[model samples]
Target chain A: MTNGSLSEIYAKAAYPLLGHGKRNVQVLKEALEQYEGELDSDMYGSGKVIESFQVKMADILGKEAAVFFPSGTMAQQIALRIWSDDQGSKKVAYHPTSHLEIHEQDGLKELHHLEPTLLADRTRPVLLQDLREMEETPACVLLELPQREIGGQLPEYAELEAMSAFCRERGIKLHLDGARLFEVLPYYGKTAQEVCALFDSVYISVYKGIGGVAGAILAGDVGFAEQSKIWKRRHGGDLISLYPYILAADYYMEKRLPLMGRYYEEAKELAAYYNGCHALKTIPRVPVSNMFHVHSDLDKEQLEAAILEATRETGVGFASSIREREGGGCYYEVSIGDRYAEVPQNALQQAFQALGRKLRHTAEL
Target chain B: MTNGSLSEIYAKAAYPLLGHGKRNVQVLKEALEQYEGELDSDMYGSGKVIESFQVKMADILGKEAAVFFPSGTMAQQIALRIWSDDQGSKKVAYHPTSHLEIHEQDGLKELHHLEPTLLADRTRPVLLQDLREMEETPACVLLELPQREIGGQLPEYAELEAMSAFCRERGIKLHLDGARLFEVLPYYGKTAQEVCALFDSVYISVYKGIGGVAGAILAGDVGFAEQSKIWKRRHGGDLISLYPYILAADYYMEKRLPLMGRYYEEAKELAAYYNGCHALKTIPRVPVSNMFHVHSDLDKEQLEAAILEATRETGVGFASSIREREGGGCYYEVSIGDRYAEVPQNALQQAFQALGRKLRHTAEL
Candidate 1:
């Protein structure tokens, strides 16, 4: 809600595939009300429906137990706090670009009073070399799937395994900020459980890719999950009833989890089309997930207006608003979803073509 | 979710009122769907309806601003942490029965590292002598209105004023855990703002007396309230959308807040009826809020079974489960609400008569 971000996000919510927005009321209402089973009691975020979803998530993620929370920020923070407490170290490692470091306003430091050991370069995954270079041991190493900050790029599997081994050999905790875990699972070519086995705890977003209304599931061993619930209650994320989010997540996970491979392929196709343009470039020539970013030389506001106008005129939402990048460049993310997959690539290409001509015309004007 | 508390709570939720429950789904659904106004944009706890409710709450509490949270546990903990950080001291004083101390799983200490300076007796409100006897300065003094743990007991307004003045002179913050603020306001015969004027900050439960499904409002000066939003985000209290809770809170506050006086009177009438019983006792003898406990000489489980059986036998539900009190007494809370408000006193008295008979029979068996 800062600096009118809520209103800005609200403004964007009016567009479908608003560059991958997960929440919409009509969509959510239909998703929720269509449930045929009993609307289970919403007590402490547990019930047959809520627990079923949580267990399925744990099974998929290959963890022993799981708990749902109102937000991932709370889940990730709690996971870190639990690991720190268990390992008896207040220091934890995460990329500078990690959601906890950037979006959470230094919650790890201010709220938990924990020291953060910044690991690796911000542009990519945490390499083993980064762990070797740290001055002091951290209680946990936090990893985000596909490194959302830099266009959903992930390191090679062997590289991640070495990083895991590095942390394991030192008896440090391994945690995953898997907000987009489902989106990037295809890149690993392994089951979520298989990928998750290397980590001590994993936090999955319900709304991001799975298209639940809003919530998260943190998976780990029973003890860790139990501790996370306590932390969740303490942090206010222990909502009285999480049925709406849980039921929605269950439906969406079942609906969307299987489509990730196609979405990933669509991302590549979309990125290939975007890169063919003279002024737009995809950060990773190939997307490691169902998402990629299009860095544009065009002005951000202008590009957003053009894309939005094109969306309205042609019903082809090529992208959402453009985010101005550092060093005077502007970019917008392209997250391929079921909604985005519905539009023909030719329709998107035409929208981009019109956008380029419109930008050229604006330059002429 | 602690020590299977969630499961236990869930088990209790199967029956209406669990003897001290706050919300239900059918009621919530009807209340939510009947809302005729346009659904506000799902934002970070703000919108026309949400902000309007927040501003109205601030006005009612005599504070500069108010922010809504999904849970009171989060609101109070964040409120304490904020006051502690602002004063540069972590030690905070409260009665042993304060929600933060008893129910929050040491979040104030574990998450915020704030030292709790326990004060006063658990069975009664904090007196001036308690503050006078403090060994060291504290960052804040937390008080719960008509303390829920003690069947909603409140100190004399003058005593509270003295305590507030003592903290004011010492530059200590005074935070009120007013989870049932509305339910108790009639006892003081003061408006919410007038009574709230004594405290530096106050947290009111939207779900408890107001009948919303779940959420809380932490009210304070402009700076404190503004800072709370940041803390809320950090703690994962800031959800993508809190419109449901906010809208429900708005509707319930409007529908239920004005009934406090009548409910307060009803509680007195009900307590008078119960105190007239042979073995059952209303702790305060007179009502302080719309709630009080009925302590009985019978066994806890036997009393609970009798009440449930009575509820099942008669269409009227007169009471809820009894909690075994300290010193071998069994007790249960009677929180008067829309459902309980409808039952006549005669019906309730007869139910108790039947309960006594049932208990006697069980004793004989």
Candidate 2:
């Protein structure tokens, strides 16, 4: 009878999973039972919950302090901004596909008024020589661990250490975009603390891999984070209270972190299985983490419909189609999380089988 | 024993009253029960709950579209960034104490890489002539209704209308920093639509007077907002879902918006009462909105301790000290909301009596 009918198509098209639903309910209950007062001032004015979360995040990341923000975009951008401001320069260097450069609509240039010196080669990791060759000195250098656009590939640990040293000698602050850090941990065979130690500041997303409702933590030295708090307030990132996210994050971390190793193993197995399949080809033969891209022969839309139908009928989940690659077929990113890891390998084979059937049916018609 | 003490003074603060615990719990339960597997895709992402709130907000603010952000800081910064990008200039004009300036550690300068042409005369409303007098044309101008730092005073509607006309004539965009716009509305006898109609874009906080957990809405023409979505994702404000704040905001708008008029009337009466008191002084003789600054003769820390003690004993929540004003006394801000309105007026008078007694005790000792 209302606007619900108009959006029903979208509602039906989306995947329905148990983890997302359970997290939503848990957050809602926390909101109702705990938070009730002036939204702006309640959190910023005197609520100690955000401060507690910051301290916890700082301790976890092995930093002196941490600040919780509404988005990693602001966290990373602000880190760059602070680095630039301290150096009294307007230049920041980062990968060409860095979230700030591609995603922020030139916010660095437009909002923070800084200039980005883009490192152009997309296929390889940024080397010290590339940074040293820049005609102008940059205020900071940003590195995204397991870059998202490139299917979560990471630079070698030795190269990262060299990059850190290079930045330090030149007095450039280093910032890490660890949005999918949990995924990268198993690939590096390193602790979160160890990886974060190399950067002056590290930003980690709570909702992405941790499976909390929504939040991010920007961890750094006490002075750096203290400065970030001022920036957070200015950017309007400080909330009324962060207890719901904090509490849920605490719970999720305990439950999900241990399962990541299993997820990584499952993803590797899935990749191997897909490589052997006649109808599909995986972009990366060996995924560095729990996610890899799959290229399929089936039409993108038809493949999606078949997958959705199968998921609805059989109660299994998998991505249907990602963006079309440079070549003829479409690429779908298969991510292994706590729940997805539990899906039987045969179920995935069945999903592809369903896609084949749908393609055959369409051809006959 | 449990990692850290939860009973610390900072930890014992109250949670914001923003959403219905039962409804939030129920929705979260349903999400977990019905839609746990479909968390990644953007099409029907469980985050649609946040989208629902945005739709409702757009309707309330009389905008073509609205985007929900994790933080008001990110929302407003992106709003200004979009305005500047559209205008092809990077300078935005606003009050010196505007959240973008005073609070953000110059992030507009550092992160967005934009410059503020400060329009710093705090004595009067920003007039059309102010824009005319600028040495160089600015990309955008921001107006903070019920300016927070200056005791919540707002410019006259006629003046704001003239400012809007000036911006249109110059092809400059006007942005309304309506962080506390709800408080200013009843005083001006205007709806949110009327106030927002004067600007190209408007930013409203859900957690401020509305009393929800942290969130903000940036409402504008659909085109401007579509661009903001890109900026939102880049800033990391886009969450897996926003149902908790959205549902709470929807409930708050219905329950709180109607009651703001009553809070405004009460604030006016309270301002009048404080003005008549010989020992206490109200900064602005007439209450422009629900918030006002109080200058008290009592010592800052002792007065704060006394006020907290009185609040605990009497269940009256009011001003806590912010900073020292020009006089020997300290300045405190009183923001009237639904909770404070429920307490009888006599509680305020009783609190004042308690304050006087505490001050006298300090002097005698």
Candidate 3:
């Protein structure tokens, strides 16, 4: 095939996440336009986009400076390394469900050469008592905002404040894994800056809710970020051109950030909708953000097939999976985003109605 | 603008790079296509493309297996880390200008927790004596082919063979930073397999010459690569949907690999063309591969302006400046690639003519 045909095929196949949506397309287009006519090459050092993204992130988080990285793992690992170096300690304290501990394949130990002191029984939220109980004082403590693996539960504001103060008093640096920071903002009754101020450093993802291509920005004081840039390049996060991601992030922030509150409100209503349904049961009585899980009596394979079929029929998308619950029935998460938020309440009701019909059919069979 | 318009803009801007250009784009496209419909999000456990890429790379390098990484830095660092762990030593020996020493921001020390024992000698290639003279016994030694920061020079085949044998005798693993190994092949009068066979692990870039979107493949024994995959996820190298890179690499191998021999010949001819000219001097006497540096007596600012103007006039690209030589002259590298090789000999001659004219004009003023 010709280059044009091949590119079309590649685009269609590769960018499955991009669909025929005005909002998604507009966000990406604006980003491309903003950065189209520039070299943006890092002739002297780091690329221009990376530099600007870092600066912007730092300012937003009320930090002195920031650095853009290709992946959150590199950023978090480097952060731990710097903390360890500063404190002259090779051990870090964090909850068991922290991305660094669970997701990063023991990179903190294997790559960074640091030992993790995992705090067990963090099913609710981390507290100062938990920090006080540690036998060995760690160089740094990692806290995740609205923990992911455990259904997005966050600690109370007073407890979080106490934890931060305790770390500060003990000369321990606090690092926040704000992967879903935006989602946590409304729930905590705080702004990004307000929440980030409690930590020495913050790492945010541009691709998650912000809907950028793929990149991360780690924000911290000038000294910290400068050091982080060196680590960034060391980890091979530095690229020749990063304007695409930077521009996409800028566009997404402008377009989608304002709608985050709406997403939260919609999520609450959706959770309430599921709670009232007979076939479906809500996991967390109240969602912390725009995400919650639903328990259902339907079979896994049958539920997945039905959801896929129903989405095709109704043009409304919902995740379908029978996840084994803590008690008895299976559960699957229902995450509401800007896309789902735009669907009218009546349309969502209709989707649930279709889901009910499908579940009943599976039950009868 | 609409999403269609946005995609069109992205396509236009990214077309040259990602199009079927017989470069990295082809490889990335191929990789993405292979895992087209799979939605496996995790890059650590049961990584999507790493296992397959490793298998393919191992076969290409004549190794037992291979590992996939997000960056060459991580791959090389992990290789050294594993070597150190196996040998129960923290020190590794490498040339002063090796990528691990200079480019990676001391990641071997900070991230991998390895001590680099530099084998320094600006005058000649590293020999067995250099390795023996090291105060500490290193766990491994790194050898970079066509050393990048040093104008792409290589050690003689006899010297390389001796070094390998010495390492073998000492029970030290040898690692090759083959970032530009493809460029080094014709110069050494050897194939990739022959060079790679001397090393325990090899790291190659898919983006550099192979022309993928962004990726590196670490080839080694099957067991070694399997372990590296776990490390890869820890480093955040595991990406979602790597089929694009795989496809692009497959296509680039088919189209660009055949042209490299011709590129080598043309680069030599180009170097000779500059050597005979009075206005410009070729460094290193002869071109080893498709890259060489040209030393000019012209002022740095004037030279940069002239090169920029020449690019606008001829639509041919060249790096403005690499660094200043010790002998009061500015140096610029000319990389002969698919694009550079396509320029006619006359156009190449004209570019030089344009440079001279701009310099003379500046002198008159």
Candidate 4:
């Protein structure tokens, strides 16, 4: 069955553990109730709703200023471009699977004419040693904390500090692709400001962990923030009224920031359960944040059937579909959020038991 | 007083002759009530809400496809860039006062590396003769309907047909900066499709005359529309959830499209009122669309005081603020909309009469 059909089935399951729920107009409706002041839409990224959220985010991230953008892709690209322009170098560096490199269709290269050096192996996070060993130093070094492609894996905090120092000493700008920044805070044992202190610029996604509609905040020194606003207008990220996004972001950030620790705990708990299943293991073996990827030795179709069987029996679904590996296995990403807590403990236990049985039987066959 | 304070006064007036009303959360709330189907938010510019709207707009504009954008600036830039790329030329042409040349911080130059040759003098539309005399042939030519910078003026339909035929004969792409496309339909006595047929691509603003929160639609042939989507993602115009914009756009277009003829009529009537006042006259001496500019020989401060005085006495407001001319005069733009209908005729007459007396006295000073 297609992923769409699988989602339909999973959506009807008694216990669904993906996101808060469907992202719909109701999402905005629920968030709007939280706002008490004038809902005056922000005009070209100005006014109270947008400006207040920018200020709050900047303060939370301990930056001099922040600007909201329509996407993390735009914010991060502009962050690197600004740094590259200042350093008079066109080269920036990130992991091989960096969103800019993979997801953005070479927007940086095409739009900004910025060249990127892939600093690390695709399977792991870029460490301080990688920066030190690189043949050519880039103007900016982007570190995606909880590097998403490798299943929310983050380099050690000390390693990040070392890299930050190295970049600063070498006059290289260090930028954070912190799309899941808040999710990793519980594991890092630090506040958002503390983690952000190590980076010259930080780009955070409001929709990812905060469960808002889509938008991002790029925070840095006042000059960087000012430059980003100009770039934002150029990129058309300055929607005349971004208050819908700002309102949803402000409401959800307030509601979800306090629960990040719980989500992280739940991710670890869920990963442990997956590891107990037959032919299944999670990347990192344990989650460093509220997200992880579950891998299976069986191919995608086999795992899909097995998961479908288990979900049908237990009324507790896993993912809608799985991605096939190059040679053999399959995998799917899991992100723990508010819905994870709603899954009944007994039902989850029963679901895992069924999943384990189905995988084992499928393997034997 | 600042424009912000003036807006406060105008907002409170009994006969506010501007937009429908305050653009707040209520605008969205009212629009959401109109949607009957699934309110699922579009994911990365896909799904039923976004797709259906794109299809509807493309049909309305008589194009093979269309793409929704966060801003008209982004849409038009990408449209021109695509045509330039296809034609294997780096040069485009537009009116000197085109939004690209004056407002966008030279994004076309900075991002796309496309050079723009300004074709027309700032005071009028770019006619066929202007294109013929341009020193070099550009890959694309942009025309902004109502030529906003010159007070919402337009060339004759035959002149537009000539321009289109000239561009097509020479294999040059013609792009319409149709921000106020609907507003001009009544004057042209043509459907949106009929007008759009003359151009290879058209970009329409959702918020300007449609009274939506904010968004834009770029409509063209299938291939052009597809290429625009890639450029959109590169520019980060593809927000994760654009349902809020889509809902408002759909709702407001339906609510306002039928009223375009009425708004156009009201605009002409309003221009006459301005022209009748001492030292006050509208550009074109009449309106060709639902929008026009009212200029005064008096200075900005003088006009502001006169406007404030008239507004206070008659409870009818004209504009929040006036823009000073290069040397002496001052002007303000007015676009007729739903709010204009609510303005009592007697009050408008009295307001203008009082405005004329105040202007006559101010000019004598």
Candidate 5:
């Protein structure tokens, strides 16, 4: 909870709500200590440590090979370019809320000349029916497992199978933006290999859920991986050395990879508790992948003030931040991790009760 | 010298010739150790250390702002893209041997749709007369200072000034691929600022002569730097942390930057000695920078065998490899650094004497 970015939150949190991953500086320190016997790493990206990390990730993802990138933004763009070039079409289909479309500042179009077509609605997971309805076919279809922007909702397994078959029949390549794949696995109740089997390529973030410093992994068949290496050099994703990120990633993967199941279990219980509060509501009413939308009737500023007052007076945290909801009022993205998992039911109830007392004078919430 | 790729040469060198940059792992270790008292950098690329380094570079290059990139490939590509977009023309001009043309595998054309026009002959520096005779102006004219592949030669200072003025009058952007800017300054007898002032953008490699692991700096006016940041993010040149490269560059700049003058002086002396040999000839009969081309009457394999035997018997190494020359025999790029600076004049004379003796037995001459 006290990693450099989270230190501000930790200092203020009477109890910090767990998020998608860990950010504890002390824990990171302990993680680096695990590399005790290691001297250092290679001059550039290739070395025993980085190679072993990539091999382990490849095994976990059930891909023929995996290459580490300094940024997911670069990896995803390169993946789309590869698929699009092979098909001789620049068109790629993605959800309106996909990271490539929104977060990357249109790099796909501006840098790589990739044309992205928005599929389905921004509020829900993309469906097979959505693809069938398109006027033109795209060279690739990119699916974000447990879509993040809409509070972590995944398509049903049968629906996903239908969509995969549809893409295969059309000869359209499928790629997975599996940044949150590890955390979402417990809900899917399947191995990573099973989920990735439907796609030609998959990209996972090293830090999003794995608690590495920063890096991304793109995995696929041997040919795709080999070709991506050339693009990686062109895009400047090849670092002089990746050992620091690999060491941290290896330590956390060993410690946290298997613990996602328990984290998801605790998340559902916590969502139920949040729903019990009259001022707050969870989006789906049931947790899917340790995350859901949290809404309050108060506007952004008032809700923030109330939370601050509650924390000041009773030393309890309600949420990280509140922003104007799409419909009205204020909302936040609720993500549960180890910190929230450790909070006792009675203690959480007290936290909500204290926040309620502070918001009693507010009319909206 | 015995890092990874350099181990083969290090094991054989009674004394090895420096080509391009440092590969000494011990020096790299010392560089990393300098940051022992510093905490880890900011989450992304905006820590105090990174900021200071960028500021220092901007000051040295006399630019309004400077940005550090993970690789020179990203920096140059982004710079070309920016100039092309601003000029509303997709054409960029360069010498036939430009790194952007030959080394980057035509990424400009394939990735960004920028058309490259080879403006001048490969045997000599790009002259203003060449641009004047062109039927159409290019979006950007990229000039490499003391062009790396052409035995490190630069245009006359007056000719460079005339080219800058011509581009300005024509509303054409000019960029400098000053990857070896620091080392080439002595030849021009001008500060980096004086040279960079003529171009709209300049890129310098942190590792080429500065001895960092790997990184590059792109500097220009305020607006250009701001625009380049977006491209930097889009290209994935932005890293989670750049403090290691920053720290290493900072250390080496302090230690190595001032010594370039001596290296250049010694390089001239070494070239003079090699030019004296009957079998080996130095390009231009003198070195403009700390590097020159050595063309020998001996073919590639013969040159390698002679160098190996020379090192085995007398413990003096000439080069790593010899490439087939277009005309006949073989040629290699010889770059001088601190290691070469330490060798006495008599030793280099003796080494060249031995090479000439071996080449005497060859029929290629």
Candidate 6:
């Protein structure tokens, strides 16, 4: 039998559990089917469609206003830049593994000429103590809940409150990188508004856990939102028409938000299956959100082969690819969503058994 | 009888003589229906959807590579930044009315820290003489063909060739702001590639003159295009999915590109009708493209009322809005496209007649 790439193999499977579904135009088509709003396109962020979505997001986040951006990268950078400009300090602080520091090609530094201060070690979530210990005062402090790079880990709500208060007391603006905000809410037992209330500004990805095609919402006070509009134009985030994104964001938020709790439960169960394997374990030993990292003592090639074997035999796909760990072994992030619940229980059990068997063989080596 | 705003009245008319049609989701719906390509979403500017379109655009522009951006603002700025960085110069030059200088909230200045030198007076297109007269050598010179702000006027092709040679000889990178590139091609008797040949880099707006929802293509050498990808991500122009824009761009370019000559002819005929009226005259006195500005001796209220009366009576919409001229009177830009030809010839004549009669009555005052 021919061996295809894992993603190719997963794509052909009966139950490929990951995200809401495949990233395709079908996602947009499905979202459009659910959309009951206006058909008119927005012009450079104007008109009813973009405005209504912005208003809805702002209300849900309990901010005075909100602006929609084409990407979370632009939204987050502009949010920090605005705060930095207002404070007359160019320094901003965030976790070492923050999207700005890693993913954005130093846009914050190169484009905006703002200095970024990495707050803590890359392996853990930033704590309140990390803020208090900073030698230099930053214009803004950014916190990404369910720290994605480290494996979707989040600090306690009480700890978040203390950090928020500490930042507020020191006249530092706090911004939330809530790209996977909805995924973390079930664990916090807080509404999006309650969680957002702790930060001066918040940016959320509509495309991440929400299963929208692509877009983001940046929420803050009236003035901040207004300023973001100008920056949106400057960044070219203000496309002539953003209604498709707005519609999809609106549709998916409605469809999947209520299922966050269920997805969280599914994630825990799935992680347990992985842990049952001889060489496999999950980071944090428990998931705080609907996503967690599955690590294996086996190298990437061995882990991939085992997952592929399980997927092909039982028709239950695990992951498309695995990342090599710094020390040794391999890992992959498991993000639970609509697809997770659709995996047949019996097939899932068989797939895990197959995976366990392969790992047992590897452990014997 | 209750009187509505001119745009409100125009929107209700049977033949709104501007653009391909309405700017709505239906544009996307129609484009999607015509698309026979892959439905897979591009993840952060990867995948076949975006890649194929970029390749197609690069081929059409005769460039080694191309990059798609959410807006022309981002594409143009990045193009200029790359040129400036390569030349180790921060100064770039463009027409006084360039979109980068006027419409982009000083993004080039603020984000990239590039200095802009306005090359010529706002009322006219930049001449080669103007380039020769400049004291300081700029890293790049941006030339907007059929410059939108000055009523879509263009310099002679020979002048363009001369400027291109002079810039090349002086180590100044020449960039084309070809937002309305297709509209001017009929007049220049040049293919897009031929026109783009003079410049080191080129940017085109798919939305304007092409009637896509929104997007821009920046094309140049392979290395330049590769660097733009990084800048695109930095500016957040690299959205998770841009297939909708790509599909629409592809669909409309196929539909409308060959019809540029027809639109150009219609524009001239329409401009003649305006000039025939007592108080109306078109900028250029003769249109060199599918777009031109219609100036009226009448004030804003007078002009709007007269057009509103003609639109309501004849069901042939002229314009939705008018802008006040610097000193006095008012004017509006007419961009002829699919909708212009759809207007019945007889109805168009009568509409202009009504417009002329109203202007004559006002002139009697």
Least lDDT summed over 10 consecutive residues: which range in candidate 3 chain A?
Answer: A14-23
Prediction 1 TM-score vs. true: 0.90
lDDT of 4: 0.90
Clashing pairs in 4: none
Give per-residue CA lDDT, model 2, range B1-365, as digits (tens): 11122112212323211122222233223333333343322321235566666788898899999987766777888888888888888888998678887776665775577888878565554666778788888889999988888777777888889889988898989999898888788889989899999999999887677766567889999998888887776555665656555655666666678877877787787777667644466756687887777777755665566556545555444453346655576667767775554456576677556655655666566
- Candidate 3 backbone overlaps, count: 23
DockQ of each: 0.44, 0.30, 0.23, 0.63, 0.31, 0.63
Q: What is candidate 2's lDDT per residue for A126-188, written digit by digit as tens?
A: 777778788898988888877766666677888888889888898988898888787788878
Report, to 2 decimal places, the DockQ of model 3.
Answer: 0.23
Query: Candidate 5's error at A345, in angstroms?
Result: 8.1
* lDDT of each residue in A153-182, candidate 1, tens digit only: 887889889989999999999998899988
Residue lDDT tens for model 1, B1-365: 13233234334433332222434445445455655433544666655656888898899899999998888888988888899889998898898988788777787877788898788785688889999999989989898888788778889988988988998999999998899988888889898998889999999988787877678999999999989989988888888767667767877888889888888887888788777655678867798899888888776766666666555544445443356777786887777776555556566666667666666677677
Candidate 4 residue-wise lDDT at A334: 93
Query: What is the CA-based DockQ of model 6?
Result: 0.63
Interface alpha-carbon RMSD, every candidate: 3.1, 6.6, 6.4, 2.0, 4.4, 2.2
Q: Write the per-residue lDDT of candidate 6 for residues A78-160, one digit (tens) a residue.
A: 99999999999999999989999999988888899899889888678999999999999999999999899988999999999
Clashing pairs in 5: A44-A240
- lDDT tens digits, residue span A1-365, model 5: 11232235435676767663333333344555665433445445576666777888899999999998878899999999999889999999999999888877788888788888899886689999898987789999999988988778889888999999999999999999998889888988989999999899999987766667667899999999988888887776666665556666777788778888887887788788778766777776787787788778776777676667666565555566566877778777777766776566666777778767666767543
lDDT of 3 by residue, A237-333 (tens): 6644344455667677767677667767777787887777656766566888766667676655555656555555565656523356555555666
In model 4, state the lDDT of residue B290. Answer: 90
lDDT (0 to 1) per candidate = 0.77, 0.69, 0.68, 0.90, 0.78, 0.90
Chain B of candidate 2 vs. true chain B, TM: 0.82
**lDDT accuracy of residue A154 in candidate 1:** 88
Q: Is candidate 2 or 4 superior in TM-score?
A: 4
Where does candidate 5 chain A have its weakest 10-residue lDDT segment?
A: A1-10
Fnat for the candidates in order: 0.47, 0.43, 0.35, 0.58, 0.38, 0.63
